[model samples]
Target: MSFRKILVANRGEIATRVVRTARALGYRTVAVYSDADAQAPHARLADEAVCIGPPPAAQSYLSIPALLDAARRTGADAVHPGYGFLSERADFAAACAEAGLVFIGPPASAIEAMGDKAGAKRRMLAAGVPCAPGYLGSDDDSDERLLAEAERLGYPLLVKAVAGGGGRGMRLVHGTHELAGAIAGARREAESAFGDGRLMLERLIEHGRHIEIQVFADAHGHAVHLGERDCTAQRRRQKVIEEAPSPVVSAAMRERMGADAVAAALAVGYVGAGTVEFIVDAGLTHYFLEMNTRLQVEHPVTECITGFDLVEWQLRVAAGEPLSAWLPNGQADIRFSGHAIEARLYAEDPYDGFKPQTGRILHWQPAHATQAGRAPGAAASSVRIDDGIAEGGSVTPWYDAMVAKLIVHGRDRADAVRRLVAAIEDSPLLGVANNGRFLRDLLQHPDFAAARLTTTRLDEWAAAGAPLLQRPAPDDACWLAAAALAARGDVPTSAPAGLRPASVAWQTIALQCGSDTRRWRVRLAGDLVEFDGGPSVQLLGQEGHRWRLAIDGVTRELVALRHAGGWHLAHQGAGFVFTEPSAAPDQRRQADPGRAHAPVAGVVAQVLVKPGDAVSAGQPLVCVEAMKMEMWLNAQAGGTVRAVHIREREAVSAGALVVELDIDTVSTVI
Candidate 1:
């Protein structure tokens, strides 16, 4: 039953992850990609590669027939559907079985039973597992019926889509006034994302800790639990930081929870790696959430702590290898050691409501720099960066925003946090906005350090804003930028041969950053750049986005990247975007009096206001869709719409003008 070749039916870090282990075990690996990922790292790393379809997931990764076709064409004996896409799809699993291909996951019946949230809850109840009290009604349940169910369940419950993962189809309703709109919005988003609008109600656990147990099973009926991960640090219901061996889960509690998780797995007769999630309240009471029927995104931390490759276990179990062969004594003999933490590196702007960023990765120096030929002892202090994109790659708005997973292991929890912070600070990533600094700040936060975490921790910090936020770009950024500019031949060298060094013309350069403009006056004498005769500055050398600097008897490595005219600089955990002064129109300024521009790149989902229509301040003008989420563009001030430049279904780039408004005494038109 051993596989000769394994087709990784996925993309990004997870796909590359499977390929790495499969090839190591002497199995040839095949990778599938979309048009946007033709040059993706996973595609180029595999022994064989195939283009599935276009950028959109439906036309490619999520297509069952396409995946099966790829397996047949590549002569693959087995298919590994990495987490997401069709990993939990029962029909897809059954299709693989029918095609005489081994689906390296649970049986179709197990997936079918657990894929339905309500059905899984019913089974959990039957298996004596504690579950949150809620209404799991039938598909025919109408809006009125759902409203009634909410009334009975009480306010502040969750409106969750039964068939979808992520936060796509989730909404929080504190009262009945917002219940209807929440339901409608959740349904619409769920239908668009997962093709199923079915929903369920659950009691919202405020300030609760999200804990999940990793369970692995084999065809021989042997199952084992591999500790738990605390994923309470989240934003928008998606986990940002995950760590193995929850701080609150004592030995007694771990044993109880682990046993319950094992029961949940055995109840469904599940095989392969799965996660049983639960919500732990302040009083230490736990409630069953849902069971994921595939490998989890946070599985790396578990691997780092347990010293076992879960993906390898999946392959072995699928090849008819008994769990007893790997572990003679099963769950009882498994040992847990040390601590591990993983942070999700994403191409998103944390300052801007975590808006997804899409663009070219001008430079990418991963956390540990590279994954090849590293000495074994380096693993102790090194941060493991499981990344997917390269320096010249473009992160289009076609898939998940996650760029990599930064996992670090240490002798203990405090050591792990320290290493993680240092790793984030040393990471060289540029060209797109990210939350690396924010993650670093979170690791050092007093609450995080003291293990005082809950689901609402991120939300609380976001609401406080500025003072509580991560450190902003420091004043040293200017010094680094100036050094980079001087090194790039922006400074006059040797006084043009005619004039003496004293007669060299003084140069003044104006730089604009954000909303502020600053001017620097300097004169360059060969390698020395004199700033009003303050200090003789020398241009060392440039390495990627970083520059080695020697200023005022201090030598330091500064990160500075050149864009069009100015340089992007980062110091500590903060980043600053500096643009060189140019005569071109200022995009951030209100140059065109009444134009309303798009703040982010996305497709126009709806035009809320028509031309000549009056709009009030904060009124919805248009709705833009990007990365599977919809954002409403509201009017900044009350005005009358003069013209509409964008229509529904049209794609718009960031900063594109979408409307012209006539406000008070001014009216601008195109």
Candidate 2:
């Protein structure tokens, strides 16, 4: 390759992923980080790192000038816009070219052609590609004009951002009454997220499967599609899991879709990596969705099945290599191997509307075993974990909530699912509420196992109360293990002396969950730990965070960590936090039941309530924006606002009181 040094202009797993591959290919890599990510793993992994700007993406990662300056200072000859941030921004690509930097992506014109969803749909229709029935004309974007056209398009419409993807600035309108609101909300979100207030309307495919073809191209005008990735497993349009060699796609259908996808790439004169997304109905008919003009977050799955390092391909192509050079056999020789699945590990609470969470990672353990799953043509099964954070690293509110990408490959779909579930249970990402357990349960769901997933099915399943979300609770063994571990500390002089073992001190430990605490006296009993009035538990082995314990002769392996003044335990796919007892109970959580609280740390986007305003139950009192998500805090009960503690555009911590309501003296919080 001509380029010797490359700069990865993104964060999280995508950045690290690019860096690892580029470095392996003998290219020096530079990583750019914001102030908050000074200690991020991606930064440390790069040969050189640069501080671009502040935490917020607009002031840092999205700033083209800052990125180019970083590349210039680092003497980087190539720039890799890894997904999100400025990956699809045509201006960024153009600027890189202007600065004599090889943009390891499609040309600026290609990005512009495919970046706009409306424009891409128009071009696809002209190219004879099947497109969803919707409105993509630029006749007008006024509320009245959109409403009139939407009326013609009919109900259950999808409002999508014209400039970007990832379900941002997208909303589903099921009725005419919601069309105007959806338009406004989508426009505002689009403007905030992509700096574009434009939108397009699409007919909602409620029972459709989301499939995207991974396409690659070269300067020689040759392109090929890397089959399809079944992204049907989604929640609220956000992909939760993605797999390759879709369970539903037949060989004939794959061939047809692959041709169409390759045509879509060539239509835009695309070079480098891109994805052509499609929405397929139950009848096996597919419609063109928007195209992603840069690398995808779930590219690992396709790489695993194809045995191609896509980043390496992008690099070689950017350096003027043709398709024949990178692909020795070309498209005709392409092969799809074992099934590969990728599950996104996000720092979010699935039970609480999947709200984004922020915190320092107290403990980070990636699942790796001598036996897991193998890559294409590998000797044995192994696990793949692409993460950009480490222990003590913080998951801030300025970026995407995803902490890592856990990918696995197996001989078949069932084997992939089984290994992925065990992988999720084995990896522990503590100090932040996450969806690990929820993903495990989801993978185990019969509908998912049977390839019965659709775009709206996950949401429908949750709304119908299928109970996919179950909060973690400690069982007897876990409780005893936690107490016994906590008892290893010195006995406090303030407490009365209890029964003592020969060498190990007998101590009382209080393990608190929420407002309840389970205090127990534990003492060492040979190889077993005896609870004062409960059964004795024998700890067979204690490895790093993995403990093998036997209770009543029943053996179990649990992942536990005593960090950040608490015990983070995982048992049977459920995660629990049992904190040490505080000298005094927290008065904040005990006091205000009618207070509107921020669910996560974020900036106050808007304050809808005042000190004396009257609010009804569930009325939106404030809007908090965190990790690019706008969350509205609602009132818990009908009452008069007694006080407002936050202002618009001000930062607030998690559980910070935003507003107080004086309701009939009853306890309630939201």
Candidate 3:
């Protein structure tokens, strides 16, 4: 099965990722993109590109007919379904085969066998692989039977979709009273996400780490495991950080897990790339999780440590090449060098329950300059940025919120963590609310440094209202910078570009960050500033989004980027957005808690209340779904519903009013 051209039937970073390897391997690549991704990096990186349909995935990326048409138009001989949309669909493999195109993945039978969570669990169990004790259902998945099975499996079990992965179509039931709702919600999500409402129950491993082994197989009956990837750093069951050669998995443990993962692959007669997931307890006992029968999103971490390209492996296997051709020593040749860590960069507000954010990327500069444990002028950087977004690009709500992936390699785990943290902190991603500061904070957290993270650790911190969720409050120096910026008066040089010793002196402004307000009056006369409540401030100079200043008698350099009529300042890993009420009033600066408003831009999934309906404080009144994540707009204060401004299925922008109640507005945290 030799193919000269490969069509990538996906978008974003994964599509670009596949195109990179295929191009490097001397195969011309074709990219099929939706209207939303016409100018996306993936579309531009391919040898040829085709516009499939409108932005809606059903008409574009997820449409098999559209993909086949694109392939035919480009005269492509192979199709590479980059993870996510239709990547795991067995029918897609069969369709590609029928269309006389090579699907760069395992056989259709393997995907079907593992696509269903229950079926995969049963198969793993039959293959002598230990599986989590659960009801791999026998067709009777009714609410009553599932509830009964939940009782037997015990409380705090996991309700999961039988046909999907990625924490979607999954719910955690902590008690008997929650089982029914969990079942219903999980089913709805499962149906929506995977078109499969079949449910399964698994006894929750109260304390465990998420571990997966990357396995590759070829048509010559050769299979090998590429070691383990620890994905335990997760929030809401979605992996945020992934690292190779898990900090926890010992050599012996890796052997056992790797062998089991390979067996799980061979059990299905799998060919190409696949990942067998597992959950390991403190006792070192591991249970089989479902196997993903395609290349994984975190495959780069495996590649970094092993010095092998998994995508290239996929291409070779799809072309019917034997493993011996690429891996002269098979499993023995697979080796780990140094440590590597990857953190997902998402376009979301970490301070606001991690709400997904959508807007254009006014500025996009990652911290590629941060050399890892080397000289400042190191010739090469160990940092690798797997990003699909570009400056001036729009992060539409129509797709996943992840904008880029930051992966770093170092001599050790500590070195890698340090480099990654530096990369995240120095990266300036403006325009939309992002998770850069939050990622840095998480990386610097003592718990993460000590490797004390569990699957639910982030959730637990959030539930406890830990300060980890809040943005770092501005200090005196920060405030001085903000005030100086407001007073800088970015006008003609005659007025003062930025404290250029001009005749114009006195400037007073009211700056606000969140609920904290500060009234500052700066009288700049001949290099002397009347700032502070006297905290210390002196604008040394300004250079296009950068400022050198003396604050509190100490010289410091900071980034002050202006976007959307607001000032965005950054230093170290802290960022604060400030707005002047006298000029452009920020909608969020004084938000009304009694009114119903969307925290993000998304289609209204449901409206739980109507006009004149009585509601209690904290009761969910509306549901908004974006990028497959749901956010509930809850009543901040109990009162009679005065009006419902937005209805179900309506699309709304961030801070768009949805409902209002007849009550005095109360201050509430978003």
TM-score of each: 0.90, 0.92, 0.90
Taken over the whole model, the C-alpha lDDT of each candidate is 0.81, 0.84, 0.83
Worst 10 residues of 3 by lDDT: 370-379
Model 2 misses residue 45 by how many Å? 0.8
lDDT digits (tens) for residues 25-62 of candidate 3: 79999998899898898889999999999886767888
What's model 1's overall lDDT? 0.81
lDDT score, candidate 2, position 227: 91
lDDT for each residue of candidate 2 in 1-670, tens digit (9 for 90 to 100): 3789999999887888888878877889999999999999889989999999988788999999999999999999999998988999999999999999999999999999999889899899999999999988585788888898899999788988888588899998999999887898789889888999988889987689999999999998999998999999998788999999899999999999999999999999999999999999999999999899998888888888887778888888999999898577888768888899999998888877788988878767776743111223333444688888898888888888888888888889998999999888888787888888889989999999999888988788767766886465677777887776666443222233353333466767778875568888777754567787787777666676777778767888877777667888876556688888777856554545576789789888778889888888788888888876788888777889999998887878988988988885553444
Question: What is the descending lDDT order?
Answer: 2, 3, 1
The TM-score of candidate 3 is: 0.90
- Cα miss at 393, model 2 (Å)? 1.0
- Candidate ranking (TM-score, best to worst): 2, 1, 3
